[model samples]
Every structure is written in C-alpha cells, then in structure tokens.
Target chain A: MTAAGNHQASRSGRRLERAGIRDVAAAAGVSITTVSDALNGKGRLPDATRRHVREVANRLGYRPSAAARTLRTGRSGLIGLTVTTYGEEPFTFTEFAYFAEMARAATSAALARGYALVILPASSRHDVWSNVALDGTVVIDPSDHDPVVADLVRQGIPVVSDGRPAGNLPVHAWVDNDHEQAVLGILDHLADSGARRIGLLTGTSTDTYTRLSTTAYLNWCERVGQEPVYEAYPAHDPCAGAVAADRLLARPDRPDAVYGLFDPNGTDLLAAARRYGLRVPEDLLLVCCSERAAYATTEPPISTLSLKPGRIGTAVVQLLIDAIEGVGAGRPVAQVMPTDLIVRASSQRRSTRTTVSPPRSPEND
Target chain B: MTAAGNHQASRSGRRLERAGIRDVAAAAGVSITTVSDALNGKGRLPDATRRHVREVANRLGYRPSAAARTLRTGRSGLIGLTVTTYGEEPFTFTEFAYFAEMARAATSAALARGYALVILPASSRHDVWSNVALDGTVVIDPSDHDPVVADLVRQGIPVVSDGRPAGNLPVHAWVDNDHEQAVLGILDHLADSGARRIGLLTGTSTDTYTRLSTTAYLNWCERVGQEPVYEAYPAHDPCAGAVAADRLLARPDRPDAVYGLFDPNGTDLLAAARRYGLRVPEDLLLVCCSERAAYATTEPPISTLSLKPGRIGTAVVQLLIDAIEGVGAGRPVAQVMPTDLIVRASSQRRSTRTTVSPPRSPEND
Candidate 1:
C-alpha cells in the first residue's frame, strides 16, 4: 500500500469521527475554495495542486458534504423521474414491462452521467414535486395540462418527457416513438395477412401515445374502406384490461384481426380467444405492443411491436443531461426513435404465407 | 380560489423566479427562523402561526432548498436502494420479476412517507455512493463483508437490506423470508404427490437465499432417507440456466420431481422436459421460486413459491423509515415476512389425486 492506502487504513481504525474539509485544506496547504475546486473539479487550478489536494483529501478520508456542496453550487446532482399515476398507486412503475425496462435504462444512463434518479409521483398531493432539489426532471406520459411539468419549467428546471406532451403542456425536450408510423406498419402487416378488418384494444386516456396510435388505426381503416372495431379502457387499471379484451372479443362486429396497444394485451387476447374457442392466426389474428420477451415462449408466441423503450430511455437521459450541461444547443432536440416488430406465430396467417419477415429494425434518422 | 391559491396562481402566471424562504418571511411579516420552524413543524409554534406561515409560503410559491433543509435537519429525505450487479448491467433489475415488484413496492412505500428513492448501483466508481445525500440505504443481497456497507455504517448511515447479509457485514436492519421453511414445504408437497425421487436446480452463487435453500434440500433428503440430486449454475446468466436444467434432467440418476431455486428455472426446466419428451406431473414434477403471474398461463401452468416480495418491500421500507425518523428503537426489528406458494398444474399428479391443498402461509412468530 502507498501513503494514501496507509492513510485510509489508519483512519478506518480510529472510528472516532469523520474527516472534514478543513483537515484536507490544512494538510494540502491550500485555502478551502481551492480544496473545493480541486475536489469538485470546479474552477481553474494547476494540475499538480489539484492532484495534491485530492490525494490529501483521500488520505485523510475527507468526504465533502454533498448537501453543503449542493447548496454552494446550486446543483444537487439529482434528477427527478416523474410518473403519471392512473390510480391509487403512487407510481404505475411496474404496471408493465415497458415502464420497468424504461426506468432501468433511464437509471443506468443518469448514473453514468454523474446524477442519481429520484422516483417522484406526479399525482402526490403534498407538494412532493417541489420538495426535491432536482437539477432536472423526466416526466413519463405527461397529460395535456400536467401542473408538475408546468411548475418545474416555470421554476427554470429543465423538464424532458418520455412521451410527447399531450395538448399544450410544455417540456424542454421530448422523446417518443413515431407512433403513427409504427401503427401504420402494423396495420399493413395485418393487411398482408389477408385480414378484412383490424380491431384495436386501446386506452381511454388522451396521452399522445394512445391518441396518436388510435388516430393512425382510424385513418388506416378509412383509407382501406373498413369499419373500426375497437375497445378503449382506463389503462391504469390492470383488471380493466381483461374486461376490455373480453368486450372486444364479444362484440358482434369483431374484426378478423386485432392489435392491442398495451403490454398485457397479448396474454389477455390469447386467454379471451381460448374462452371463445377461437384459434389464433386461423380464426382470429393477434398482435400487441410490448417490451416483454415472455411473448417468445407463450403457447403460440404472439407477435409484438417493440417500442424499443431501451433506446427511448437512453435517448431521454442523454437529452436531459445535455440540456442540463448546456450542450446540444441550436437544435430543439426532440427525438423520434424507431420501433421493432418481432414476427411470431400469432400475427402471421398460415394459409397465405410460409415466409416470415425478420425482426424489423428501426430506421434511425 | 381563495386569496392564497389566487396569489399562487397569479405568481405562476407571471413566470418569474421562485420565492425563497426569505420572501415568505418578508411577505408574512415574520422572522426567518419563525417561518422555517412553522413550515417545518419544528419549535413550539402555535397552530394558527403554523397555518399562517404555510399559507404565506404557499401564496408566494416559496420552495425551500432541499439541500439547505438537509443540512439543517441532518436528513435529506432520500433513501438509497443498492442492487448487487451480476456483470456490466447497472443491476439485474430486469433479471427477475421479484426485483421489479419489490422495487415498485419500496418506491411506493417510500413516497407515501414523504421520502423518495434513489437507484444506485452497488459497483459504481467515482465515489458514487457518497456523492448523493442519503438518509438511509436499502441493500439487496449484500455479500458478507461488503466494503460499501462497512463504509456506510462507519459513517453512521442506517442500512436495511432486502436479503440477510451474507457474512459478518452489519446492517441496521434486515427483512427476509424463511428460506428453509419454504424449501422444506415444497419438497414435502412433491413427496406427497407420489414422487420416488427428488432433484434440485439452484444457483452457484453464495447468496444466503441460494445457500440456505440448497442446504435445506440436502437436509430434507438426509432426513427422508433419499439420495441427493441437484445441479448448480451461475443464476445471473439466462442461458446457463437452460443448460443446467438440461444437464439435471439428462442425468442417469435423474429424480422424478425437481425444485428449482431461481425465477426462470421453471420455464427452462419445462423446455428441457420437452426436449426429453417427458410430460409434466406424469413423467416429471416441477416447482420453482418466482413472482411472475405469466407462469399461470404457460402450457401446463407451473407452481411457484412466491417470496411475497410486496410484503418484504413494504416491511423493508417501513423499518428503514422508522430508523430514519428514530422510531421503533426498543423493539427487536429484524423481520421475517411470509412467503406464498401458488400451486398450479405442473406440480401435481392429476391422475393420482383429485384434491389439492391451498397455499402454505408462513407462521410469523
């Protein structure tokens, strides 16, 4: 062990009290500002002086107070991840594979950029959003008039959202899939499978994802001279999804093929089909938007439109960090990531086609 | 709107800067300390004074600096949730349904109590752990003698782990399931269903969950006068589980029934059974520990030992918050939450028995 190692070991043995910044300044023979600048990588200081300050600080086991440093620099190094709740749950964080995967990626990306994420609920009643000294925020599925995003932006904190903000809600930067294009491509795929009509299982909320996808489905039906067969539910309610799936299947005007908009729709549709003794891809074709790999092993693996939440998460964080760090200027920085359609047994009609297309990779612009 | 709300709405409309505590004090005609004490519920302020100060603060849209508040109170209202990583991924956060459910519950519970969770990797470089101000930490499956725990405890931060610490690493509190009881119960359930031999699929890691479960299986075999049969693999690798499951079934002395210790082992073992052309519950019986509901819809739904991660998560956060707020000091606070076993088709011999027992609930003593 070198001097620093020996110093750390000796400090560990005492267990009396924590080392302070003053001890480091005295030991390194520099002022406290120089010590702060050296440790925080702020201000201009000679390389040798900075290294000496850091070495002395480490050897003395001086942990600069994160709270004090945050107060001084006015940057808490904390990012708030705000999720819109659909019910009594504080956050619909685990409602689907998409949110969980997206959150995981966002956490990883934020940490890599030297910031930690704080999970904040947009529906909390007790000033939850204002309590945290967040450098910025990532709002998932912001409503048309989300007061949290409005307040944060009003306070001059950069707000980046995962979904395109509904209505006129303002965000510093937004990231979303080309929902219209993804829906259109899926409709085309279903059409190629010789379907006369394509029904939709969608959410009742007016979030941009549900709105855009629903509009795309309607436009496609009009263009192809087919009637729309769909059911909308309050997506935040998990049980409501099953009811909606069954309702759609029970409709007398049910289409031959259907696309569900949420993650659990694949399983819900399959179970509903089983209940009615409907054979998938033969009597009724099936597809859903999902991020789960479990679809790969279902009874007859269901084809899924992958929103590529992993890419969206990574991109959202990169943009948020860039805006925080004053990078990526001269551009509005809105990103529309591509979606992947993993072809499986459920979506393809066996009588008409023997060849299946491979997983469609998103065309990044 | 009332005058206070109207004042807030008007300030928000102007879109200027946020009001500080001093602004609140000036507006409310009170001292800064009086405003702080009243808003923070500190000091012996009367109810009317508290209400007045809060009203003034809300009217001015005064948001206190969380950093300054943290320094003043020695609490950041932030808890650290540390996940042990398998490899390059920040966390095996998506590795299993258990982590996802547990994290969701923890986040909800934390938010309900006016604190937010920070997701931190257990293996981050650059002083990642100490860089954020944390009131406490929740460590998931911490290794014995973890330096992170040591350093954190040395600094007097309360840490509550989801799993029992492996070695001598000290945590302020811990919550876990009784692994031995859960394993023995599963083994007996299989034996009662006409199993001549039993096998085990477990992880190669030394995590207390894996170690304790495997030891219980060995001990049960010893007591029951049956030869031990088992296969161990690095549970973090998704592909390794398939190979391990196959090797266990392909053994010359393969057991009639198998109990897997990890989440994905049920699916992996089922696939391996298919390769061997063995039908479930007739040629073989299977059980695994998992929190996924998808197991219910598999081809022959698989039985699972639910660790009751929701309860554990809620308990972990309760203990952590209690410690953070200096509550529950005199009581013996180490918790052993109950586990629920959801019995499905895969673990039963349908031909031999027409009856099935309900879920086994743990006795909390």
Candidate 2:
C-alpha cells in the first residue's frame, strides 16, 4: 500500500507480461528491423544471421506484438471466409460436402501462409463484419446482388470468391470450375453409353453453377432431339432432393439415364431407383456432382462430377493472399479450375467395358 | 490545383469515411451511451424509443468501432474455437461429423449471444494466438499439457473445453458426454440383441473418448465373462479405419458382434464383413459412434451411438458466454450431455421387432 510497494507492484506487473521484440533485439545485439526480418522470414538476411537472431528470441521467449505489427503494416493477418445459408441453421457447414471440403482447404491454405481464417456468415450484420479488421475475404457462391460482397468492395477489402460472381460484381479475383463444360461432358458420356432419352436433376436456385449446368443440359437435350425431362428443387434442403429424385423417376416418361446437380442427389436417386424396382446402370444410369468419397462405396458406385473443391479452395486463398501481400493486387485475376469426372458403375452402360472397382475386392478366399 | 479544389477534395475524403458511433448518437438525437445501448440490445429503454433510435442509426449507416469497444469493456466479443489436429494436415474440421455438428451449434450459440467464433488451431504459434484479443476459448479435445490452453489460462482468459480435459488442465468450464455410460449402454444393447462376444474397433490415441470407451468395453467384457476382442489404430486416417476393421475381422477369435468407436467405422466394419463372407445381422451385428445421417441409407442401415454434438456445442458456448460476461465466471461448471442410440437393421436381432425409420416417407399416389 506504500509508495515503495506500489513501485514494486508495477515492476512485477511488467515482469508478468511476456518479453517483447525490443528485448529480443537487445538480447540478439541486432537492430529491431533485423529482428523483424529474421522472425518473419523477410528481407535479405543471411541464414546464419537469421538462425542466431531466432535463437536469441527463443531464449528470451519474446513474442512480436501482433497489434503493433498491424498498426505499422495496416494488415490484420486475418482472412474472412463467408458461408451463405438459405435458412437459419447454424452449421450448414455439413449440409453438403462441397462447402465443408472447400472451407477445410481454404483454412489449410490460409494457415500455411501465416494467416488465420475467421468464419463469418454471408448475412452477418455490418456492425459485426466491421468490428474486426480483415485483410481480405473469400466469398463462397456470392449471388448477383450480394450486399455483403458489395460492402466489402466499397471498403477496399480484396475478395476472392469460390464461384463465378453473377452480374459482374467486381471482386478482386474469383475461382470456379468450368460447370458448362462439365455438364456437356456428362451428357456426352451418357449419350455414348446408349442413352436415347437422358434426364436432368437440377436446382431451382439461380446461382451461376445451376444456371450454366441447366442451360448446357437443355442445349444438349435440344441438339440430341430429346425432350427435357428434368426436376428442379431447393438444393439446400436434403429432403427436397429425395422428393425431387422420386418425382423424376415416377414421371410417366421417365428417362433411362439421369444426371443430378447437387451432392446428395446421387444417393437420393439411387434410393428412388430401388423403391421403383429399377436397377442402376441397367434401368436408370446415374451421375451427380459431388466431392464425397462415400460415393465410391455405394451399392454400385455412383459416378460423380467432382468440382475438385480442394483445388478451387487452394486457388482462392492463393489469389486472396497475393492481393493482400500486394502481388497482382490489381491484375483482375480470374482463374477457372478444372472438374474431374470419376467413372463408376452407376453411369456406365451394361456392356461398355468390365469395370474395375476401387482397390478393395470382397472375393472370399 | 486551386485552393477551392483542394478544400473540395478534403471534404469529399471526410464524406467517404464510414459513419461512426458518434454519427449515430447525433442522428438519433440521443447520448452516446443511449446509442450504444440501443444497438447492443442492453439497458432499460422503451421499445418504441429503441426502435426510433435504431432506425435513425440504420439510416446514417453508423458502425461501432470494435477496437474501441474492446478497450472500453475489456472484452473483445470474440470467442476462440480451437480444433486439435491428429497429423500435420490442416483441416480436421470435417474429420468427423461430430466436429462439424459441434462447431455448427457453437457458432450458432455464439452468434445468438452477439458474439462470433474464431476458428484457430491448437498448434498455433504464440505470435498468431497473441495477436487476436479473445473473450474466451472453446478447446476441442485438448491434451493435458497443451501450451495454448495453458497460455490462455495463465493470461486469465476463460477456456471451456468440448471434451473433458485429460488432467486438471485448469479450464474455466467443460461440456462432454458421459462416454463410459454411453459405451456401457451400447454393450448392453448388443448383449440384449444376443451378442455372445462383442469385439471392438477402437483408436490407439489417448484421447478421453477412446480411453473411456475402450476401458468401458474391457470392463463390460470382463463382467460378462468373455475375453476381450478388439483392434486399435489411429482414427484420424480414413484408410486406417478400413484396415483396422479388416484386421479385427481377420482375427482367429473374430467375435459375432462388434462396436466401433469412430465415425466411419460402420461402413468399414460392413465392408470387412463382406470380405469375410459374413452377413450383417445374421453373422455380425454392428454399431458405431457417429453423427452422420448417411448411416441410415447404408446397406442394412447401420446403428449409431450419437454423442449429441449439437447439445454439447450449445452447452459449451453458453458456459463460455457466461464466463465471458462475468456471470458465474468463478463457478466450476462441468456438464454431461446425453447420447442417442439410433436403432437400425445392423444392431437388431433378425426377428426382434419391426424397425421404425426416420419421420420422412415420400407420399406417392
């Protein structure tokens, strides 16, 4: 309680705090800038010098002040990854494997580059969004009139989106799969499998992926002189997918082959086939867009149009980081990643070729 | 440039800046405290007056400064959600359906409390963790000697763990399932279904879930006067689960019934059974702990012991928020949530009873 005690208490408070960068520099007998460069792996520093500085810092247990660094660099070393939801469910994170896989890859990519990701909702209030300083953002499937994307653009935050932005929403960069080409490839694959009448399972959503795939399918159906036999549903609802698949199969003029747009449509359609006494590949050839490994284990593995979410996620983060670190910040980078069409029994015609299953065979000894 | 042009440029620059809390106060014709209260849904205020102030603030596009608010309240309104990794790979976010569901519930619960969750890694370096100011942390399966959790606790930040801490890790609160009770109940279920010898496919990890479940399994086997039959492997690797499942079935003393302790164990066990020319219910009754709904549609529909991740997530967040808000902050809060056993064709005796599916069936005319 005395003046001397107060002085001692203040001194103890200082001791309780972790060592700072200045202490590291003093301990290393180097300039503060040299310590910063050595720790951050930046500037031209000899390997020996960097090692020596790091050892000194380690010995002192000195941690550089992130807040001080942010103040100096005007960067928070934080990336915002936005997930848009159709309803009030908290973690549609697993509504589909695509979003979960894409996010996992993006988080991995961001962490590798000394940055951390903050998961924010697309419908986040402006106050919540603006609270933390973000160096950039990755918007997953931003719609044409996304007010969040627009707001980020206005605030001078660089954005890289997973899907192609609709209506020319000026994001700094964007990465998406060639959906049209993928759909057309599926159509050709089906046609080659001796499909006279091929149907489509798509979504009622106006997102670019659905739009492009549907347009491509309609165009293919017209060129092939086949009537468009397709069913559309709200893609966010898994139950809706099952219902739609059933309706498509129950139609009076059910097509012999079907291609679904969403991830769950494969299992839904397969189950629907079972209910109607239709055999997959023989009675109802099937293909769907998905990134799940579970497809490889389905009764007769269902073929898939893989968006290669990992590649897209990695690319989006790379572009966003480049923008943040001032690399190609203004180059208007737009990347188009490729899709993979994994062949399985569900989509192959009855006698095209002998199918080899995944490396596991259940043949008893 | 003319003086008039210079003045105009400076004025425009000021205009381009976002409206601050002060602007809201001025626009709403209220004091700054009243404006803060109105926006944050705090304090005693008439509903009509609050609505009027909120409308005025919205019209002015006013945004509060997160940094300033943190400094004033000594709380950042941010929660840190740490995901422990098994290997060098970045995303264990989707490693299990449990994590995805838990995180979803946590995110929703945090958002409901006007707080946001920040996903950070358990192995994050000091520089990265120290940079962000956090109100509290939710650690998912932290080891006893985790430096991150220790650092947070030493710094006087509250930490609520999802899994029970291995040792006295000094967490402010924790929420976990009664793993022992759940495992024993699972054993009883299989026994009631006429399981003479119940083998286990478990992980070699020292995590509390594995430790408790395996211990309970051994104890139950002893109680029933049966020899322990089990196989252990690293649970993080998806391929490892399949191999372990095969190894268990390949054992000379292969039991007629089995329980798996991981998410993908059901399918892996089923595949292993097929490889050995074994029928599911007739030859090898099966059960696994998982949160995946896909199990419902698998061949013979696998039974699952759901840990109720949503309840755990929500409870963890509520405890963390209560700690952050200084409500029962000093209270020793530890909660145990119940588990759900979803009976399916895989676990029931062949002629036990008619099984009920989930509450959805496509209404067909």
Q: Tell me, by lDDT, which candidate is best.
A: 1
Candidate 1 lDDT over A1-365, as tens digits, reads 55545555556657556677866776677788999899879999989999999999888778878888788888888898887775756455335567777777887888888888888878765555666689999998888888888888888888899988777777889999999999999999988887788999999987678889999999999999999999999887778889999999999987888999998889899888877778777778899998777777776778999888878888898899888888978245688988888878788876776444674422221
Query: Model 1 over residues B230-325: C-alpha lDDT tens digits?
Result: 999998777899999999999999888999998888889998997897878789999999877788878778899999887888899999999878
Question: Candidate 1, A204: how far from true, in Å?
Answer: 3.2
- Tell me the deviation in Å of residue B220 in model 1: 0.7
Which candidate number maximizes DockQ? 1
Best by TM-score: 1
lDDT of 2 at B47: 92
Model 1 steric clash pairs: B144-B167
Note the B-chain TM-score for every model: 0.87, 0.86
Q: Report model 1's TM-score to 2 decimal places.
A: 0.89
Interface RMSD of the predictions, in order shown?
A: 3.2, 3.2
